[model samples]
Target: MKTNHPGPLVGILSARKADGSIAGNGPLFIALQKKLISLDGKSFVFIPEDAGIDHIMGYTFLPEQNHWKKEKFRYPDIVYNRVPFRKSEQSEQCQQFFTILNEKNIPYFNPCFIDKFELYELFKRHSFLKTFLPETILIEGKKDLFLFQKEHKSIYLKPTQSSKGKGILRLRLTDAAELQLDGIHQHELFKSFDHFWEKYGVELLTKNYLAQVEIKSAKYKGNRFDFRILAHGEDKGYTVTGVGIRQSQTQDITTHIPSGGRLLPYEILQTNEHDNFIEAIVPEIGMALSDRYGYFGEFSIDAGVSMTGHHYIYEVNSKPMRFDEEEIEEKKMEQLCRIFLQLSDYEN
Candidate 1:
């Protein structure tokens, strides 16, 4: 299987494992490599430290060998920032690698991890999108938290820099005058707001957090569900690749699969009006994000239909995780390959 556009190599910037393989989702990388090969393009995964003046020490997949081959290659036509963790992406070496990409004029999309608070602010600026956003405030102190909780009664405190539902706290003010706190592990009842803040304030205040009003998401069979819509750039705009549903297993604070959420059939949403809502807003979101954040080849939206039947946008992830659904995953791979070839202008 030979590719005519072999020169337009795509580089996936990621962390290296202890054993020297590319970190992040292993199956996703392998699938991406195979997809690019089928498209008559090429891709490799490299760490920041592997980059050099004129070449990069990276790993390319060999179909016959059934292994990733370590080799030196010329700078790729474009780089895809897939650095899995925020800590790794923010490292000095990663910063230096991005500088080299800029200096050499190589293109890339999804530059870095977007702060949750900053993304909310960006979306708030657009009048049409503003209505869909939950009332959000940057939690700076007990005062901010208290006021937000008072206004919404039920609010979610989330770390601005974290993902996969990590570091999330849900606070609800019950009619009994008790403040209830729900997290990944424990649920506690605080006698008052001050009491809750006294215990959790230091941790929340010291780190960046955002307080958002809970949407009371519509549920199915007693489990709250949300839509994960993946979109990719095409013809100077973005189009929907697929939509997936994640339902809460324990009615946890988030619908993230890692946080005790389970996948549901997409058919559940296909019969509802929410499907139309997702289709309408996804392209708008992609355009707004790209306009403000620069070229975004791909992104995924975490959205829900409120109990009142209104659509609300919760979060937009720059680096989307692999979809468990086979159809969505296939569409994602096809779109990824097309986006890579289009961005690199690979002639095949």
Candidate 2:
């Protein structure tokens, strides 16, 4: 791979609120840019444009009004392309620029275009992903639910396009997982199908739905503990960067940080009994996804292990979270930035 003497031009693509505050993914966006800047004196430069299409490379403005231009124009020798996870409100008009960069042959993190269903299907069809993937049934309508229930006892209903684990619920004939109905949270149990549907029927009516067969996760304090394993890849394979466990508040069904859950380091989880298992298994989980799905670099893999010593890969991220644990330092960020510049040369 050719070396980018000075790093490539870079850009941060993110949504800012109507009041002009950076939106959800903005902090990490800026952090990456700063890291690139520090790594190569003036090598990486973030193109300033609409949130619609962002490339961490060279860009020139078309002289449009309200541009609020922050810097001079530069063409991208390479692009970082940390585009937002979801096409967002601020990015609604910024779509075409990403394509422009791709057409011009600037190597971006992920290709400019991806069918949203493409990765999901790859994950589902791959043999390795089968174990950790709960029985996922595409819910077309009410009939899909009926057919699934006939074959399985419990299924989790989740939105395909939702993030931060939103609009997710567990459906089963049990008193275990409780939720709110009419704004009331209770330990309500469902005795039969009729009883279950009566409460959540309206939510099911919404169009896009995904049903996953339920699997028992390792529980702590009656809640669940799952690892968000962060990784980055090159042509070689997916490499485990760090593994952090998410512990939910007592009795909470989901283990999302924003949903009253907290992140725990690996030390808290191993506790002697599982040391050998962690040493043996955690490093290898990402290999399956990379081998099957062709994921190149920078992924956050969500995985889990039960107290019974079973390991499963729940999901893979093409774009991972900002894993800046305290142990991770400025020098490491520089290393990652340097690596990205190198990846661009090889990919190009």
Highest TM-score among the candidates is held by which one?
1
> lDDT of all predictions, in order shown?
0.86, 0.54
Give a tens-digit lDDT track for model 2, residues 27-134: 444455655555552332242343223323332222234122354434455545454445542253445565576577655553222322344575566555444455
Over the stretch 182-288, how does candidate 1's per-residue lDDT look in tens digits?
99898999999989989988888778888999888888889899998899888877888888899999765888888889998877667558767877777888888
Error of 1 at 230 (Å): 0.6
TM-score of each: 0.94, 0.73
TM-score of 2: 0.73
Q: Give the TM-score of candidate 1.
A: 0.94
lDDT of 1: 0.86
Worst 10 residues of 2 by lDDT: 59-68
